[model samples]
Target: MKELHIVCKVRKKRYRYISQISNKITPNLLKRDFKKDDPNIAWVTDVSEFRFNRKRLYLSVIQDLYNG
Candidate 1:
């Protein structure tokens, strides 16, 4: 669905925008670099789907770079 694509882009781009400007939003914003040395600095994760018993199972993660 279109909404799914829009949301997926939003989720991925949220971290990108936040990394550059702290508590600020801009129309012409540049993408943020994914390089940090803090535990919560790099919170990267992914999601996937698998069929189980004819039903869909989704998986997601919110990882910490320090612990991982």
Candidate 2:
């Protein structure tokens, strides 16, 4: 790999900045119901990280639960 000029990229570990734990709890508004009848209602979002071509990339996706 060194003779062909190919380098490997290593992934680093991420750490949290906060040290204290909170006791607050958030209510579940969806109630485990993911199915939706309306097109614009019940939108969900997710963030993902990917390593490709020796570069790190972040992807954010937002989709409607009705058709998705």
Candidate 3:
């Protein structure tokens, strides 16, 4: 029977780097209020884009929350 000894080298510790810059918060105007008592009083609009055959297409829609 024979005895063996092993040796290992230590390496320097590394830390994660993060940016110190802060992001600005924007205020919301609607504040999640989507209810309306009368028609045409409140409306929501949305826009979307799609790409097909190396071309760009855009679609815009307006929705009325009152019975629509």
The models' CA-based lDDT, in order, is 0.66, 0.91, 0.79
Give per-residue CA lDDT, model 3, range 1-68, as digits (tens): 13556566797867777788567788876587787678887788999989899899999999887766
Best-fitting candidate, scored by TM-score: 2
Worst 10 residues of 1 by lDDT: 8-17
> Which one wins on lDDT?
2
Go through the candidates in order and give the clash count of each.
Answer: 0, 0, 0
Ranking by lDDT: 2, 3, 1
Between prediction 1 and prediction 3, which has the larger TM-score? 3
Which sequence of candidate numbers ranks them by TM-score, best first? 2, 3, 1
Per residue, candidate 2 scores C-alpha lDDT tens digits across 18-62 of 859787899988898999988887889999989999899999999
lDDT of 1 by residue, 13-64 (tens): 3334456657765663214555556666567789998889999999997776
lDDT of 1: 0.66
TM-score of each: 0.43, 0.59, 0.51
lDDT of 3: 0.79
Candidate 2 residue-wise lDDT at 32 = 86
Per-residue lDDT of 49 in model 2? 89
